[model samples]
Target: MHPHSPDESPAPRPAGSPRSIDPRRLRADDLRYLLAVSRTGRLVTAADALGVDHTTVSRRVAALEKSIGLRLIERGPDGWTLTEIGRAISDSARVIEEAIDRVVDTVEGQDSLSLHGTVRVSAPDGFGTAFATPALVRVRRHHPQLQVELITATRQLALRPSGFDLAVVIGVPAGSRLVTEHLTDYTLGLYACDDYLAKYGRPKSLAELREHPLIFYIESMLQVGDLDIERHLPGMTPAFSSTNVFAQLEATQQGAGIGVLPAFLTQRTQLRRLLPDEIDIRLPITLAVRREAVTHAAVRALWAALRQEVAERADELLLE
Candidate 1:
C-alpha cells in the first residue's frame, strides 16, 4: 500500500507570520480525504473512494495538518499511519462523515443499499473460507451494493496496519490503535487417516507421537506465534511442513503423517482423532479494527454480521 506523503512532515507554518493555529482555517471538505486515507492506507485507494486522484488526497491531508498545527500522518514502510493527535482528529472527522451520511439519508431516502462502498477484510484461510464467508454472504445479501474483499493469510496483525479495513486474527493483537474483541475459541487435535495409521502404526501415547512423522505448518514461514509447534508439542517437528492447512490435511489423509489440525476442519474427514485429552489444543479468534473504522456503516454492518454468525454457529467452531 503506497500512502502518499507530500512531505516527511506537515507543511511548516509560514515563518513567524501572524497565522495562529485556528480551527476555523480547517476546510470541512478536506477531512474526507484524510478519513479516506485512514481507512484505505493508500493514497490511490483513498482517491478511488473519494472520486479524486492520489495527488489530491495527499494535498488535502497536508492542508488539514497545516490548519490543525499537527502532523496528521507519517509514512511507514507499509503505508501511512495517523499520529496520536491525528487519530484524535480522525475521531472528530468521523463525526462529520456520520453527519453527512445522515443528510444524504434524509435526501436520498434510506434504501437498503445506502450502506455502499468497499470494506476490505483479512483472515486465515480456513476461517476466512468457513466462518467469515457465511457472515460476508449474509451482509452482501442485505446490502447488495456493498463490496467486501476478504484476503486470507496467516500472519501477525500489523502495528501500523494497511490494505484492509478489518481483520480477524488467531489471537489478540497488540496495537494501541486497534480495537479488538474475542470472537471464539476453536480446538485442534492430533489426527491420522485410517490408511496413515495402518501404515505408520498408531501412537498409543504422547511419547509414541514423537517417533512418527508430523504434518503441520512450516516453521520458517509460520508467522502466527499462537501456532508454534514447540508451544504445543515440544521436541516434536513436522516431517511434512506446509503453509496451507488444507495441504497438511490432504497429506495426512494420503497417509503422510499425523496432523495437528483444527477439529472443525477434520470433522467431516475420515481421520481418526488421537489422545483427545492429552493433545487437545484450544485457541481464540479475535476481531480487530482501528478505532476510526467504527463510524463506517458497511464496516459496522459486517462486524455485527460476523459476531452473529459466530454466536449462532458456535457448535461448528469446536469439537467438544
Candidate 2:
C-alpha cells in the first residue's frame, strides 16, 4: 500500500469553509501607505519614505481604496487632497500605530532594566526649561537606563493620535479619548525680587498692585491654558506683557514688575511672595497621554513616576 498522505485524503471541513474573507480588513501595509501619503502629501515622497517606487505606492493605494470601497484621495491641481473618508482613515491609522507600538513594547519587556527607549515629552518652553527639566533630572537619578526627549516650545507641539508620548498640559483635557492624570494643582501668586518688594513694598490688596509695575503673561501668546489673571486679581492690569513666564520672572527679579508665577517654578527663586496672606490662584495641572500609548510599560512607568513626583512635592508645588 502507498504511504498515507495527509493531502491525499480529504479532511472534514470545520463547518466554516464557505465563510468569505472580510473585505473591510485593513493590512499593515495599507495603513503605512495611507499615513505616509498623509505625511508627505505626494505619492513620490510617500514612496521614498516607504522605500518603494512611486508606481508601487499608487498601485497599493488604489488597492487599499478598492478594498475599502471608498475614494480616499482626490487628485487635483492643489496636489493630493484627502477625502473625508481619507482623513478618518488616517486618524484611525494613527490610533492603530500607537496600539502597535504598545504591543511591541509589551512583547519586548518594556518594564525590564534592559528596556531602553526614548520617551518624548512636550511642555511649554518656560516650564520645560526651568521646572520640568529639573524633574527629569530627578527621574534620571532613579532610572539612569531610560532616556527622555524634551521638546520645549512656546507653541503647543503637535500631539495626541499623531505625535509625542506625553504632554504636560495645564488645565483639564477636553477629549474623552485621552488619558489625563492630575499632576498637581498650581497656585499663581504675585511675586517680586527682594529689592522690588523693598522699593514698592508688598501689595496688601488688589488696589495696591496698580501702583507697582505689574508684569503679566500675555494672553495671546499662551499655549496651554486661558489667562485668567483678571479673574484672580479683579481690575488688575499689567504694566509689561510677556509671552513667557520665565521672562516675566526675570523681569520681576530685576524689579521691573510684579509677576504672577506658578508657585512650583518660583519656590527656589530669590523672588519673594507679595500679598502671601490673601492671594490665591490655583489651577489643576494634568498629564495628557494618548490612550493607546498607556499600555506600554515605559510610558506607564514614566507617567507613574511623574505623578508620584508631583504628589511627593505637592506641598511645595502648591506653596501651601
Candidate 3:
C-alpha cells in the first residue's frame, strides 16, 4: 500500500527530445496507491484504508504523476479530484490492480484475517433471505469495515470473474475453474399448516401423499431440476406451482396444499412436518469462489465466517 515518493519531480525531458514513456515507470504498487487515493479523495483516508501513512500516499501519488508525465490529480480546498487524463488512467490502473491482486493471492495464500472492503455474495432466494443474511450480519459485527452484498436469485449464478465474489449454491458448479467446497446439508420435508392438515388430513405414507394436492415449484422455472419435489414422489402432481419458494410457503400456510419446505424456514411457523421418517430429503449446500479468489484475504475471511456460522448452526440448518 505504501510506496516511497520523491520530494522533487523528475527533471522534464529536454525540449524536443524524444519523450519515451517507459511502461516500467508505472508500477503496480503505485497504481494501487493512486487508485486508493482516488477512491477516498483524501490522503489520510486513503492511507487508512491501505494501512499506510498519509505522507506515503501523497508521495506515491506525486511520484506516479511525475513518472507518467501528466498531472493525474489535483488537490485543493474542495478535496482531491482527478484530471480528465487522470480519470482515464486511473480507471485502467484499477483493472490492473485487480489483476495483480488476484495474481498475488494465487501465489501467496490468504494472508490476513482482518476483513475489509466489500464482498458480493449470491445464493438461492430462500437461504439468502432466511439464513445467510443474518449470518453475514454477525460477520459484519466482528469486522465493522466489511460490507456484504447478498444477491438472491432463483437461478444458479455463475462463479467467475465479474460475477459474485462468493456463491452458496444447492448443487455442483458446471466449470472446473471454480473452487468449490461442501458447506453443509439441509433437510426439506413435506409440511402443511395445522388448519390444512385438519381439513385434508396428513399423509400416512409416501404412497398416500398422492391423495392430497401438492404445492411445489414450477417445473419449467426450477433452477435446479432436483428441487422439483414431485420427482422424488412418483405419481404426484402439483395443484399449485410457483417459482418463488416464499410464495409457495405462504400458499401452503393458507391451507392450500402440502409443500416441501426447508426445515429451518418452517421452524417458527405453525406448519407441521409430515412423515419425517419417510420423507427426509437432504440437499447439500456448496460454497464456491473463483479459483483466483481462494487466497484473497477479504474473500477468505467472508468464506470462513459463512462456513463457521453454518457449521455452528448445523442443527437449525441441517435439521439434525
Q: Best-fitting candidate, measured by TM-score?
A: 1
Per-residue lDDT value at 310 in model 3: 85
Residue pairs of candidate 3 with colliding backbone atoms: none
Instruction: Tell me how far the alpha carbon of residue 266 in candidate 3 is from the true structure, in angstroms, after superposition.
Output: 1.0
- Model 3, span 1-320: residue lDDT tens: 22333454544667887667888877678887776655555677677767999888878877887787767776544356566676567657755755665566566664334455656678888888877787788888876657677878766643222335678888766665568899888888889998988888878987789888888888767878557665577767789998788998999999999997888888888988899888888888888885545655667777887887787778987774
> Candidate 1 — which pairs collide?
none
Which candidate has the highest lDDT of all?
Answer: 1
TM-score of 1: 0.85
Please give each candidate's TM-score.
Answer: 0.85, 0.64, 0.65
Worst 10 residues of 2 by lDDT: 1-10
CA lDDT, every model vs. true structure: 0.83, 0.66, 0.74
On the 0 to 100 scale, the lDDT of residue 123 in model 1 is 91
Higher-scoring candidate on TM-score, 2 or 3: 3
Alpha-carbon shift of residue 293 in model 3 (angstroms): 2.0
